[model samples]
Target: MSELNTGDSIEELKVTPDKYVPHRYAGATGDFNPIHIDPEFAKMVGLPGSILHGLYVMGLVAKTSAGAAGGDPRALKSLSVQFRGMSFPEQEITITGEVTGVEGDQVTVDVVAAQGDSQVIRNATAVLEIPPG
Candidate 1:
């Protein structure tokens, strides 16, 4: 939320096990496909582990971006992200993005997350409106 110059990128977010994602959120979001929680079910489909819910991924990205932009997450205008790679539990993850500048009162961000050298998520973006004076 600092006065970012056009094209300025924000610092990346460090993720951990508790934040590994999905969890009960899948159930809360009604996306309870065992692959996101059950190991056996995940293995049945060849997943590494119960992966985080796609929307949860977006939430993390959006919240982090909002914090970076110095804006309230509740005031966001639009937010979206595309699934790229599967995020595994216990793996260290990082989320990063850039400010594509502002549009009127809105701020734009392009973001993604990675584990080690592997990209676990991609095509992330967040749009938020600046607080009115």
Candidate 2:
């Protein structure tokens, strides 16, 4: 890790949610919506198949920000995002973040998550508080 500065790029994080991720995530979050756990039901509702939970993707964004801040999750102060497209399981998802501003110890990072050409999460931003040296 290097000194945080404006325009610096955060290390990218790549994840591939397994086929059973929806089922496991549902059990942990109690979000057993068929659109996330039942592929047949999701298809019936016009979705290609069961989709990954939006919060799960947001978690990745947060992880990226925290990772850029010395891997301390508590360093993340705030996060926001817009869900742009559906993401399916067993596909590779790439998360990237860029430092857009640095004011004092607060850093603002712009984040994005994509699957192939589809932008699943866009306009995402995160604020991190880095302790002064």
Candidate 3:
């Protein structure tokens, strides 16, 4: 892990297939929405496999991005993400973000998570209140 500057961009980290995140998450979140657990259900939704919850992916972005900011999660003021596409269990998704800009004690971030031609989550922005100097 490296330190995040007041105005610095972060490198992207690919969520590898070894992550194997969907089926287990379905069980954990109780999101037994067949499209998230059953292949048949996924096909019905035009998906290749069970998809991860939007919040789950958002959480990942939040934590990893926070690392880049060198701040605690409690320092977060607001964060939001849009579900642009579904993420299959074995698909590799990459999370990339940059420090974008900063103002006063607030830091603004621009982020995106994608796999291949499919952009899973987009317009992911986070506004955080950095700790006092």
Best by TM-score: 2
lDDT of 1 by residue, 45-86 (tens): 888667766666666777778776564657567777677777
Report the poorest 10 consecutive residues by lDDT, candidate 1.
15-24
What local lDDT does model 1 show for residue 75? Answer: 59
CA lDDT of every candidate = 0.72, 0.93, 0.73
Writing each residue's lDDT as its tens digit, candidate 2 over 24-124 gives 99999999999999988999999999999999999888998899998887899999999999999999999999999999889999999999999999999
Each prediction's RMSD to truth: 2.4, 0.9, 2.6
Candidate 1 segments whose C-alpha is farther than 4 A from its true place: 19-21
| For model 3, the run of ten residues with the poorest summed lDDT | 1-10
Error of 2 at 102 (Å): 0.2
Q: Which stretches of candidate 3 lie above 4 Å from their native place?
A: 1-7, 17-20
**Candidates ranked by TM-score:** 2, 1, 3
Among the numbered candidates, top lDDT falls to 2
- What ordering of candidates by lDDT runs from best to worst? 2, 3, 1
To one decimal, what is the Cα RMSD in angstroms of model 2 from the true structure? 0.9
Q: Determine the C-alpha RMSD for candidate 1 after optimal superposition of all C-alphas.
A: 2.4
lDDT of 3: 0.73
Native-vs-model 2 lDDT? 0.93
Which pairs of residues collide in candidate 2? none
